[model samples]
Target: MQYSIGELAHRTGLTVKAVRFYSDRGLVPPSGRNAAGQRRYDDAALARLDVIRVLRDLGIDLATIRRVIEGETTVAEVAAEHVAAVEAQIGVLHRRRAVLNAVANRSQPEEASLAHQRLLLSEVERQCLIGDFLADALGDRPELAGIARTLTPELPGDPSPEQVQAWTELAALMRDTDFRANLRRLVDAHEGGLRRDLAAEVRDAVTPALVAGIGPKSPAARAIVDGLGRDPGELREWLDAVSDPRRERYLELLGVINGWAAPESMAPAFGWLAEVMAA
Candidate 1:
């Protein structure tokens, strides 16, 4: 039996335009022309159209479809390959969804909207993102490499859900203008021959004073402050440089990304010691 374009479209449950599109692609070509020169197809074209429909519904691309049509490969081979591809895509989608869910549970980060694209970055791309951030933050001064290392967030190859969320937040923090400026100040202090970590020393000294019930303005608190070898007035400058809330939060996220234990906060100690120094 012979079928006109409209007749073939009606029988195959396709729009006339879709039927013409396949015909133009030569997936279903005309068997002959009618007397008036309208295209007519036979059962063979209809059979080919059915094959095309099934493959299209399975999400196979036309290039792959053409291979099947031209006998370059078998339908079974295509289905098997497509099945694996589909399964792999599904796994990726699930992971992406979980990462988004993790982001949603936290306070909305500054670049929360771009979190998905950031998560899609490969390891090399991820490294480049931090590298660019460090270059922008610390400049090209190679002498400051040690300080840059302390700021880098190293997300592991196989990260936990928590780690992924932490990296997302940390990446957003890296873009913060004020946070970058604060980091620059830290670099200046380090380069100005204050390579010692005054913040760490103060936090360590004040932690003991805090547990021992020594008041921040008490003589014992002053004793702990003096023990750190920092002049009473200079601790405040280090505190201002290092104790930005965002800076502390960045360190918390860094710990999560690098698989370190949650860090005890330095804020209480910094505040206490700063108060002690003032006293």
Candidate 2:
């Protein structure tokens, strides 16, 4: 049986003009003209129209839909390809949202406005930029290469907004000359674990004093410092090297990107050590 274009449109919930356009495009051709010389569609055309409607709803372009109707491609093939395309688009959108959140979290709102230029970086590019900074900062300290690797940030395939923001700000921090110098100084101080050893001793001896609220120049602090048996000059040099705000922020951002537990700040202990040296 044949149905007029009007009847087919009414049944399919498509406008009459839409049905005509599809017929003209040969996607749903008329079977034959009716007695009134109007377009009429057979059951086959009606069924094909149903498919076109579904494919269009799924965001499949008209050309691909036409291929499906023409039997040039299988519906399953088209659907699978479309699904992959849609997932890729969603991934892009996810990354874009992460970038936006990173910019918004900046304390300086103007930084966010300026961040759009850097938002085009891919994950590999991000890693490369960070690696270059680490290489330059660490210099030829082959012994400290492992430390450099640990400090490097790797963005996961699906990162949180906080992670993205941390990475972005960290990248900016890496470009600062003072920040680079501070890191190199700290790295140079690591003579066969000398830096770590002193830090461990300081933490152990001075932690109790800190807890007791002993002032840095107090007699109790002096006793702790002397008992630790570290050279005051070396202690001063180490504190001067590592006790930088950007250095601390770099470690914080590393933790953020790696999902590591927040590191305890040694700034207070270092500040106390500096005071003991002055005494």
Candidate 3:
């Protein structure tokens, strides 16, 4: 028995346009033409249309449908490959959702709206971008390289929302030119070991005085500095350079990214010591 395009569409519960489209794609070509040149289909054509409908509903593309119809590939092979592609797509969507959730929780700007961020940044690209900043800031200082690696944020395959947010903020912080120059200065001071050693000495000496409420410019604070056995001039210079607020913020953001305990800011103590030197 033969059916015209309209009859085939009605029998199969598909639109006439959809049936015609399938015919154009040759997925369900008509068996023959009627006397007036209208297309007509036999039972085999109807069966092919049924298969095409099922495959299209399953998210199979028309090219793959053609391959299956031609016996060039099995339905099972195409479906399996499609399943893998769907799973990868799902993974990307989940990450994007997590990033959006994080942004919402923090009330961040809409510039990182989910679709835009997903398209712009991948985890590998994110890491590579930060790696570029680190290389530029640290130069070839061997002593600071280990610190640089430890400071690098490694996002997990399945990261928590907080990790996503932390990574976003850290990326922003690293992109600041002034932040990069400040970090380079901090690293240079650290490379010499003198700045760190001096800071440690002053902290050890003055933390007790600071805790006791001895004012920084008071005689007792000066006495504490006098006992540290370092040149007050060198210590004062280090204090002035490293007391930048951005430096403290960088550490805070680093702690968030690495899941470390927030390190206590020594800015107050350093500021007090700087005051004593000025006096």
Candidate 4:
């Protein structure tokens, strides 16, 4: 028995227009025309429309649905493919959620979001992300390639919770414009040879004075400063740059990312030198 479009809509819980749309798309074509030249569909059309509705609800695209209906592909094949795609999307959302959670705990949601993006990069892109960052820091010296690799964070295929947290903090730090400039200043002076071992020079001079509890403006402090041979004017900028807490934080994050030992901080030496210079 043939059913009118309205009947098909009623039977399938669809609107008449929706039924007509699928029929027009050749998904459930009219079996024949009625006496008044209206479309009429047989039981076969009704069954096909039921299948179409189920597939549509499953989020299968029209082209793929067509292939399934036409026997070009199996529903099992489509289901498997869709399951993989959906699982991939879920994985990304899970990672993003984890990053956001990390941010919520840290008070820097924006930076944590940046870390999420960094984690999404392909291996080549990941390498480039770090290469470019280090290039900006180390001036892209080929001879320093081994040094650069050592500095780069190699996030494993399946990183630990600690690594993700470390990466989130590190990525955010790396993206900060001020932090980048601070890093460049420190690196250029020391590693780039603009002023070799400037920090070391200050640390050596300042540590002895610090150990003796010498005041910044004391005569003894003055003698120590003079022995360093760096004019105070020349020393101030370097001291200020080294004194940034983020510099210390950066090293700490690097250790976490690369599985290295926690680096010894020069904060005490830098702090003492800055105080003396300010005096």
Candidate 5:
């Protein structure tokens, strides 16, 4: 049986304008024309319109829906492709929502909110930031190249608020050109044989002193320096350069991003070492 555009729309539960649009887009063709040149459709047109509606509701764009309706591709193929696309979009929205909730939890100022937002980098950006930083710092040195990868931080799949904040701060630090240059200089200086593992060794040995709350210039700091087998004067200079508050902050941030345990402060131990050398 033949039906006019309005009748077809009424039967299909679609707006007349939508049905007309589908017709214009060639998704649903008219079976014939009425006496006054109005479009009339048959059962085939109704069926085609139903398919278009279903596809559109499934988040398929009109272009793909048209392809499906035209049999250019199978419905199953199109549906599968759209499902994957929808899933990806859902993942993005989920991450964004997590970030917004974290911002709300802190009740940060507008500037802080913007700063956090700027750090919401995609996976590629995160990798590039870390890769470039390590490459610039340790790429030429064969000995340190492997260590660079070991120090890299990978964010968790479901990151916590702390992780989000840490990542934001780390991203900011990585982007600072001067900070990058300084880090490079520090790495290059350490390439000298005398203090190759000085930072790591200090972090390990001085952690005990820091835990004990010894001051930087205290006599007790001498014990920590002696334990590391370094001369007090040389140890003090290394501590001054390597025990940067910012570097400690960076590791703290890295732990947050990676969901690792928070590392203990090495500042106290270094403080004690510095003081011992001065004395």
Candidate 6:
């Protein structure tokens, strides 16, 4: 029922060094010593070593394993805690695999990969980034308080590659103070006056022209402007205020982050309106 350190190692299929480490760590103590002063283990020691090996293979760290062996914690409790830890590690590995797959598919340059990796944020980080930005921008507006919550982006539990990329970029943009200011300005202007209704009207009127491939400077642009039932000059001014490239990019990124289908570019529509009004 007793075994030397080397014999225990061979019987348990563990390395001799590993067995010695456990012995030194007091996880598996020697019951006695042989005449040559070598360590010897009894049945209880061998049984304890077996449990340590099993727990270690289950990804339990040495500290927790020691706690379980020392009777400071139950094996079931340790197993439960370690299971949660292992599950979390698996989730991280899954996300890393997803990122690598996306990188491989795009054949992206090294710099692009580095940029994407830098921008990638965990779900909690993504939510905090967006929530902080919106809080700073629309937090004081009682009317928009609910709307801001509705507009908040939550990436799906299992996101597509495009969604992941969009989220990374969106998080970066959310952290930029200038971008936050720009969005605040847009929100403020929209809430201030008739400009609130003008955006939707413009979207409707110019969508046809953009679809028709009408150039911004074309005479046909005037017809689109006329359809909105606004003075050409007034329409042009409104377009100038709202046709920001960053705003468009924000919407594009928002669509992806929110799992919305891609929206048509409003650039062409606004372009036509601006040209016609300026003329």
Most accurate candidate by TM-score: 5
> Could you tell me which residue pairs clash in candidate 1?
none
lDDT of 3 by residue, 32-102 (tens): 99899999999988888887888989988899999998899998999889887887677667767776666
Per-residue lDDT of candidate 4, residues 104-216 (tens digit): 66657676566667665555665676767787776756766775776688665445567778876777677677877876776655553437566677777787778888888
User: Where does the lowest 10-residue lDDT sum fall in candidate 5?
Assistant: 231-240
TM-score against native, each model: 0.57, 0.62, 0.61, 0.56, 0.70, 0.67
Q: Candidate 3 vs. truth: CA RMSD?
A: 6.3
Candidate 4 — what's its lDDT? 0.77
Model 2 TM-score (2 dp): 0.62
Model 4 ranges with Cα > 4 A deviation:
1-115, 143-147, 190-195
Instruction: Put down candidate 5 lDDT per residue, 1-279, tens digits, no spaces.
Output: 999989988988999999999999888889989889989999999899888888877767888887777779989998787776777577667667667767777754985667566656676777888888777756677778677866688876566777777777887777777666656656756654346777678778777677777765666776677777865555555666666777778778887877778888777666655666777
* Each model's Cα RMSD: 7.0, 7.5, 6.3, 7.6, 4.6, 5.4
- Name the lDDT value of residue 243 in candidate 6: 82
Candidate 1 lDDT, 110-141, residue by residue in tens: 65566766787655677788998898778899
Tens digits of per-residue lDDT, candidate 6, 38-96, equal: 88899898889889989888878888888888789988998777776677566656666
Model 2, 1-279: lDDT tens digits are: 889888989988899998889999999988888678888889999999899888888999999999999999988999989887787677667778888777777788778776765654765677678877888788876777788778888776567988777777888897787788887777777763446567777777777788889998788888888887657666677779877878888889999989999988888887887888798
- Higher lDDT: candidate 4 or 6? 4
Q: Given candidate 3, what's the lDDT at residue 72?
A: 95
TM-score computed on alpha carbons, candidate 6: 0.67
Whole-model lDDT for model 1 versus the true structure?
0.79
Candidate 6 scores a C-alpha RMSD against the true structure in Å of 5.4
Candidate 2 or 4, higher lDDT?
A: 2
Error of 4 at 21 (Å): 27
Steric collisions counted per model: 0, 0, 0, 0, 4, 0
Give the per-residue Cα lDDT of candidate 5 at 62: 88
Best by lDDT: 2
